[model samples]
Target: MRQGINPSKTDNRIQLESTHRVILSVYIPNLEEEYFKHAEKVFKLCLESVLYTSHDKTRISIIINGCCKEVEQLIYSYKEDYPLIDQVFYTKENLGKINAIYSIVKSNLEPLVTISDSDVLFLKDWQDETYAVFENFPEAGMVSPVPSSKGYLYSTGSTLYYGLFKGKIRFRDVQDPEGMDNFQKSVGSKLYDPIHLQKYLVISNPKNREAVIGCGHFVGTFRKEVFEKSPTKVCEFRVQGGSEEAYLDDPNDRSGFLRLATLGNFAYHMGNTPAPWMWDKLADLKSFEKSNLQTYSIPSAKPLSKLAVLVGKFLWVNLFYRFRRQFFGFLGMKEKY
Candidate 1:
């Protein structure tokens, strides 16, 4: 369903008139036998999350990077079916995540843009929280979710890491192992307990206004000005990682550019795992506010990573943590998500 827009009437005191609508760009690569085996399941989880949790005004744009006719048809079908999906663009060649995002973003840099991966599940009111942050703090360049998985890259910690300094930016900390059991049940996660260890979402503490400042991005939200100021090369060359998100929110200068992760996780990275946090969380999260939202789920989407799981287990055992850390781990060679 398409979201209704708020009236542009300005509050005289604050003089804030919000007309900005978020545009989400999802990159869909071909997932035949050569690609991910469970492509349909992964795609369904990603799409459903956006449909349910996003702001009503949000528009989704799919960037299909290859010339897969079936995939193109699939995206078109979605565009036609959903009123909220604004556009579907396909390229003849396969440009990976970095370049594909750069192509669209480089031109339409005004509206707030969400560059999302296809295998993600979003939580309740994810768009409301994100939009609130942007409206509240005009300086926030990027907003990410406090991830349960992909902890190394995007775990929203109370301690914000600067170049050398670590400042304690307080929020409700859910680092405890006890809460993990409940979260898994809420999302109907199928992965081992160990995977959930990294994939937990810290419900945003209402009192805190702090952000992680410069982050790792599975799903990254960026303000318009950040892109307008960046060079095309910086946007293009994220093959190894850092350059992609560097200039967006330089941690050392938080006053100028604020980088944030949603206080409570608004989304989950469905890396190979396919549990979306918004499916049924009102009861499990007593403190969580679920007003207009009900339950969301993709029962048809099952995990198709049995073979990948085996490979990951072998790698986890054969290589010591320290050995993996030394190599191109500075790059994402060691990363599981």
Candidate 2:
């Protein structure tokens, strides 16, 4: 089913004028067998989440960055397999996250742009929450589930570490024999739990604002107008050599959050990190506002990984993590999404 926009005569709010459309971009680097294998489950998870939750999955577009012949084949496979997606585009350019974002921002078709990373799992109603955040707080530039910076709430005294997925950020304090079980129990009924030990930091303390500044990995929302007027040059600060997408170059600076906070008070970064537990943790969080959201499970016919592939996955992820940290450290850089 297709829907058309009928803007009212007297409405003046910019966002309201541009409602009912959103664009999601999935940027891929080189096309490789490993890329598809490693990402397939989560990619399907993301696709399924939207299919089950959104009334308008047709609005979603997958933009494959830095395409090659192999990437083209991989994308074709996805298109043949998943029709809910409206279009698949492959770009040969090497624009990083920032430039890609600018491109999305420039597009007149999508009023809202969701930069969805390839390696994240989302709840079925993730977009519902995202849309609600923008609608409820018109000033909000971006909204996402809060990312955990440390382990679970059961971990040592309250603390946080930069996190991307649920299991990825193990809270040392919550590592007791049954700590995961305990933390899961405590975060009950909320949309998301804080990092293992830092639940207090995310949900309870009430940061007195709708949004906070930090790099939100899984997904980030942007008000198109923000990009229309965003500074072309990157902010000068502690971090170096990162995409201009970050408004704040200094990891320690909260200025970006403050800027975003002026727009709305409900933005939260979503998903777990520092590990690969995104699906599990997200599964635990309740969709407090999205009443119609539905969860679906596609039974894994079997573990897709072979022993050699499993070992290789372990090594590759480990090396990726270590190198990611060291590379950022060497450059004194951190992403602020």
Candidate 3:
């Protein structure tokens, strides 16, 4: 039987009411390299997906920094369609992306905050499933979705995973094409239609949070304590790419935190200029539904048997850790080594 999700799941450590709050903030800086029109299309799909999947009390923030007048107007236009967007910040100058994010971190408005990029698509169950991690593990410092590709440590998509028994578990991180076909067969939609794909975003039992050392903030969420308890000096200088993620790295126990990524892809990145990840493959999402489509399945959530987990971990690693190179290509690295 499919189990319903607990929208208000929270950690038992903190004695709060049954309800929990999460804020999602997106920072959009005008890219000198990207054509604003093309970027606008990607951003709209991002907002459109957000509007479809978010729940009540989940606040959305859009921080606009030195964007073109057209870009500025596009963001505001979202306000009418997506009421979840309660906060919008307009920065006078382009202090760069990291600085723009730093300003939101300073606000201290919500206990959990997600630093989402402008070019992303949040699939069904994305919001609640995201909250499930923080609710289940209060110790979790950060969480990101498995990307279509370029997830680095958290990548899923014909990628490799090492199991627990003597570097044993070796399985494809996910099976997208087969899963998508299964979903379409169930939904009666044609192949490659993005709308039909949402129904199959089933949640899996994710337990390998410790395997990765850091997270990619392209669509990552973090607890406010990671920053409020950090007690680190804030610098005026800017650090590029994965800079915000550096907070969780905390090399010398400076900040005690753990970084994690979701089991399957909950959200996807439509790479922008300078870094175009899966854009050629995903730019077609705009042809999807104008409203939320509800015919989806929530997979049964259960932990695997200890012996099963062991077999998955030990048996597979022994057989395939060497051949992982051929299956994963150069971009996909073996976790066991």
Candidate 4:
């Protein structure tokens, strides 16, 4: 009982206008508890910051994972208001953060994709600064706007191995100590060592544009091709444990792509509570003029051979990783903080 031609058969293929896609997985079950009292407000701030600062061609996909009806309605309202919010998926069942991300990323066609936590407050120029890192480092697969002093400890084996022999890596004075301190305060923990806050490892190209080696998982922009190497199976954890390391971190490292961060801090990790300062920051963002969006192509990278990756993990990452600080010191990196 179908129509003769369906009219759809002769239609042209659909084309997406965006070059970059931002994916956010939000899970707010309720507002009754003290821990989640201000969750709605914080989510609103996060979404607004992203909308205000992102490039014109960028698209945002919000996955409402097991949130209350109230939260889902709020997200729907935003979608109706903003054209940039291109996709919205709601699930009554709670899917793990990485699992939710994997669902969207598997079908994503954009050259660049940014996976961000729900509470991150993206600042102005975060997208541009992150893209600049990719432009500077052709081998970089992931770039975070918020730099971590202990970034070098994560999945940065490729950065270390390749940059070391090329003499393109060095220890640089930390550019934003106050920003680092703010991150530590947000998490309510002493995450960075005293020495780490002063100096960190950086990789520079011949053009002298430098980026920090390694990055955290809270928020990061990734090249789409790296996902081709990701595991086909969905993650098991509902949230953070080993899920991120297995799905997000390992794929980029195993693919032999460098993980990096901007030299300057362009975002903040606003935990559950929305402080007065966060409100002030959002107010400031409202007044800032939006920049013209420009698009650039990221070059394709070759994945490492299985044997090469295995040997690297065994020899350098597992065995020599602990001694990196001393080794770098021996190679003219000043140990004095």
Candidate 5:
């Protein structure tokens, strides 16, 4: 005779079962010297975030997109300091972002996966919150922190729409007038006040099953099964030659957002940027809020490098192009590094 299992007890056990696995794939190309500081900051955050949430460090996998001697050295040094980092994978040739991510699908990781840019810093609660979203809504393909209108302005796509006007809500009209203004003030700034009330327009109504299109990669998580089954190639950013721009060409154009939409997957953005004690701007916000508690902390990047960044940002909005060129050059794409 078989013993009957209590229904409530069974339910609790089911919930506690660790059926899902999460791999945090960070695309840090060793080639870009300018973003080294930013990369360091991102690494710090990733490490702490995992340490805070994960009871077993072996579950987390760190994928360094393009590898070089210097990049390897950095990873080695970090490993020496923090032993929790389980696996570090690197490629000899610099594969574009989409390609690098696709490479991980080949590895047969757990059912859940997360791809993040090196710029993202994580607090302890970040992973828990992200995982909660996945556990609660199994259909959700990805979730990201809602872009805060605080220090760094929130933007969408190549257009970079900032705000809306009362009379005319045209895209061109929405501009953050006061330079370097926080997102809070930027929302109120006459040029683009409307976005503040809308909260960056990054997420969809959780109550309603609407398809959320795009989100910044600062912090994003997803299910692994969705990626393994995805026929559409993770297209590389061609103009920029990164992952966001990459997509499937023939049958579908399902990039990150579209792919999730196709599979009835949803996403959410946390809306916390320049987080406390991480950057000068974020630190000021923490002080302003009168919150002394160190809820969480992550690494931070200095604004931009002195040389090409200025020329890229100021010269003619060629920051992307200039940076891409510099990155490829450094990666030995142009010549041997």
Candidate 6:
């Protein structure tokens, strides 16, 4: 039976005010193991850091990807406390990382979506710096707050081509060695040689605004339109492997957009274990000031023709890979690797 004179059909729907949305996928199965003993605390810090640093209008979506009931309850409590937490999805079974992320990203209405891991400590001004990169580089499709020393090697053919012809790309002194060192320590891997900490490839615009050439995948902001080119089918990998490259990285490049990062580190990967420095850094972080929210516009990426794509692939495979030293040297890389 239908109710008479229901106002639902005639009523206007509410509009979302946010321009950006942050997506986080958490998969903490249990806390019994030594590896996950401190996972809950670390996750709390990650959430707090984002809430503290993000703009008031920015929305946060948390995908509780088969986490324990305890973790779910904790997240629910956070949702109640923070108004910025826009949505929380819970799954009884574990969906792979990329699958879980795509489920939300596909339907996201915001123009900008930031896909972040469960344990990244977002520093202050991360949004500002990221937006600055997008404002300066109209071709940038993805921007990471944490810069990588060897990031220039990633799917950056378009950036390299533009740099060569425009003479805007060059090697610059690394801005934050301590921040890079912290990232290396967090991952427990030697990601860079000593010389890499001293200098890295950067691209600058006519306005003298500079950004790193490439970015890491742990955390990055993407234009929502780029994901429109991603495959509609679900990813096959359970966790890592080829999932990131297939779903996130390749689409941007194939669409002829540049992948870039901020000149300095504005986020830290806090891995599984909670280090003392993580807490110290969290304590040192300042709250986001409303006055600091600057208005800026991000230009859409110009789609490349089929001929341009074929030419880029040929150059990347033939010239760039075969004569790496000579090619990069021409773009102002001094050292011969």
TM-score of 5: 0.48
Clash count, one per candidate:
10, 34, 6, 0, 15, 0
TM-score of each: 0.58, 0.48, 0.56, 0.94, 0.48, 0.93
In terms of lDDT, the poorest run of 10 residues in model 6 is 286-295
Candidate 3 stretches greater than 4 Å from native? 1-37, 147-214, 231-242, 248-254, 273-337
lDDT of 4 by residue, 1-337 (tens): 7658867679867687898999999999999988889999999999999998887889999999999989999999999999999999989988989889888999999989999999999999898899888887877888999998788777776776656554387788889887888888888998877877888778887777899988999999999988988988877789877888888888998887888999999999998999999999999888878765456666665445565566656656566586775778775766642
Residue 318 error for model 6, in Å?
Answer: 2.0
Q: Put down candidate 6 lDDT per residue, 86-177, tens digits, no spaces.
A: 89998888898999999899999887999999999999889999998888887778899999888877777766665655438778888998
Model 3 pairs in collision: 163-169, 163-313, 164-313, 168-313, 168-317, 169-313
- Tens digit of lDDT per residue, candidate 1, span 1-337? 8587645545334431222333334444555563455655666667766765654446677777763566678778878887667767677766656777667676662356677777666666666666665554444456665333333232111112221122232223334333334435534665334534433322222343443333345676776555654654634443436654354433212223345555455666555444444334422334444356432211111111334334433443454233534533443333342
Of models 1 and 6, which has the larger lDDT?
6
- Residue-level error in angstroms, candidate 1, position 72: 1.3
Evaluation by TM-score, superior candidate among 3 and 6:
6
lDDT of each residue in 1-337, candidate 5, tens digit only = 8698878865664331232333444445554566453555545554554444443322455666655566567766766665455566776656665566566655644544556544443433444455444443343455553332221121121111111100111111112222213322313443334433332222222343322223344445554443533545545452244334232210111211111211111212212232444544333333332122222111121112233223323432444234534643543443211
lDDT, candidates in the order shown: 0.49, 0.39, 0.48, 0.85, 0.38, 0.84
Query: Evaluated with lDDT, which candidate comes out highest?
Result: 4
Least well predicted 10-residue stretch by lDDT in candidate 5: 160-169
Using TM-score, rank the candidates from best to worst.
4, 6, 1, 3, 5, 2
Estimate the overall C-alpha local distance difference test score of candidate 5: 0.38
How well does candidate 4 match the true structure in TM-score terms? 0.94
RMSD (Å) of each candidate, 1 decimal: 13.5, 16.3, 12.7, 2.0, 16.0, 2.1
Best by TM-score: 4
Q: Which pairs of residues have clashing backbones in candidate 1?
A: 3-56, 148-198, 148-199, 148-200, 149-198, 149-199, 202-264, 203-264, 204-263, 204-264
lDDT of 3: 0.48
Clashes of 1: 10
